[model samples]
Target: MQSVTLSLFRFGPLRARLWALSQMATARFALRAIPDIGTVKLCGSGVGEGFTPVPDTSVYAILATWPDHNAGRRAMFGTRVFRRYAEMADETLTIFLTPASARGRWDGQTPFTPQDITLDGPVAALTRATVRLRSAGRFWKQEPAISRAIGKDPNVLFKVGIGELPLVRQATFSIWPDTQTMAAFARADGPHADAIREVREGKLFREDLYARFRVDAVEGTWGGVMPDLTRRPTSMTNQMKVAAE
Candidate 1:
């Protein structure tokens, strides 16, 4: 599947309201077009320190997929439906669209395992709590540590960096088994805790954190142009052969 990361950057006082309005507009447009186009599986938003590593304002993220890159681009940038909402975005909006280069070990459809657990509760409960922390700009700093910890867990799946969309700062795209695993990592009293504390103690941001999530239905070309699932090869040749005219 192809994925696009849209990051909205805003500062000053009215950042939160403006960001919310823009997302609302985008969601409305997405919902209306779902029937004609592919599904908009997941959308997420969060808060983070700007490029300077200091809490800036807010960053919004949306994870959308389509049968192919061409369709996805049309749904997002080509139509006036999304454009109406795009106008509401802050002056400094930045967007990046990248394909899932390679599928991870746990990338495809599969049941989540115990390693997905972040807390000893229901998935919904954990997702809510972790989302709160993310909105507070707590999870951004601890990403590396969190990734390392999850990597050690055998149940954990592959980690892919979809590339960052520069706006308020750097925002990335990653897929997890479920919100439950994500919560366990965020709520743990580890590096994530320290990161959260930094935000709570300091009046770092001007508004609440923002994020959205959607499950994706992926299709289309694999290998060659995309990263290899097995390993990063030194070089890859096009596998699709053209027919004689």
Candidate 2:
């Protein structure tokens, strides 16, 4: 599966409306023409310190996954619909492509079991959760501790931008061995519980958005990339194809 994250940044109060417009436009095109496209997941809009904050006039969007490079290239370059959406943006657009190798599944509402998650394809399981706290002011002080606690967990792949924006104070992105592991972390309320309490008691961020997915495809850099270089290694782009085969 080919996975790509398109992040748009908008500045000013019209951010939300502009973002909504882009989403609506993209959804229409994706639903009709984008093959193997999964659910049109909406995230990062809720009020929380850990969420992505757009300028009062700025907005952002994340697009993940296409079946292959051709499909991905088609959606971004060959298609008029996506190009039109790009024209609506005011600032520079950023895109990241990564391969998603399925590790597991998340069965909503129940404790996830090993048997419940499937890794039948080259798909990555993507799950995101967010909560709004009552005391965002005090929560800012604990950013260091929060980052430390999260980093201690070996299962977590990466956590970036700690204490960056006031509205979206913290954001974490990680890869797990399987769905069961991810579920265990979610259900076993220790560190997670403590963090939730901190947010709630401190009134940090409000609203929690949670989602899990079976990554169907990925595109772009699978191995890695060197930004200083203009040309990417052929092996990196083809990594997913090799793995899927």
Candidate 3:
């Protein structure tokens, strides 16, 4: 079973500490060196948007698509580069997901193939965009409003903004209780709808991609707390135990 892992790291409160982590730019090179990884993207957050920029000065994340569980586990624990990351970060939360429907290109390729997932629990979604310079101001303006809307939505389980470039390239990773509820939030009259309309009308993005997945397991805490809608809990313990060994 191919698996996608989104791991977020919170370094600490010092600006210098956050700046020091920029060394990750060089370390990410090691991820590409892994044979079992199908695709991997090193990401940070945007300014006002969570998907702001990297060397984020506080937090950073990795979105990796693996061939299977064993491959991901081996790399997470066995790799020196990855071990250094864990050693530095104050807290790390890694979530595991299996794709149900993926319908876009990520860096010119589809990293995940849509699967026949039928899970009735929390569903995760990832939306990424490469905004054109001309439309960037408009895109940034709409983000905070859209983010507020998402925060207010009751169905939201967990969400984060992550990106490669500080402002121009951005992505959002969020989860909901189910597909229907997730769709409903998008349909509701809010900044989300407004942003969509504006994005199309303004030609906001040079490229954009969206995908939904079945949340098979979440193996860590985001802030000493698991996602609110999590349906399975043991996955974290099992994965942690393996890492500890």
Which candidate number has the best lDDT? 3
Cα lDDT, all candidates: 0.36, 0.42, 0.76
- Between prediction 1 and prediction 2, the one with superior TM-score is 2
Steric clash count of candidate 1: 14
> Which parts of model 1 have CA positions greater than 4 angstroms off?
1-16, 19-26, 29-37, 41-44, 49-58, 91-245
Query: How many Å off is the CA of 31 in candidate 1?
Result: 3.5
The sequence of per-residue lDDT tens digits that candidate 2 reaches over residues 70-150 is 455555654565565456554424333343232322222221211233443222233332324545445545544544555
By lDDT rank, best first, the candidates go: 3, 2, 1
Q: Sorted on TM-score, highest at the top, how do the candidates line up?
A: 3, 2, 1
lDDT of 1 by residue, 1-245 (tens): 33343333232247554664456445656545653353232223433211222322343334444443345445545666455435544432322233312221111221111121122211111111122333435444455664455456443332322212222223333334555675566677875467557646764433332232332223122221322222212221111111101
Candidate 2 regions with alpha-carbon error over 4 angstroms: 7-33, 42-57, 92-96, 99-127, 130-245
Clashes of each: 14, 38, 9
| TM-score, cand. 1 vs. native | 0.35
> What alpha-carbon RMSD in Å does predicted model 2 have with respect to the real structure?
8.8
Best model per TM-score: 3
lDDT value for model 3: 0.76
Question: Could you tell me how far off, in angstroms, the CA of residue 159 lies in candidate 2 after the best superposition?
Answer: 7.6
What's the true lDDT of residue 160 in model 2?
A: 29
Instruction: Give the Å shift of residue 109 in candidate 2.
Output: 12
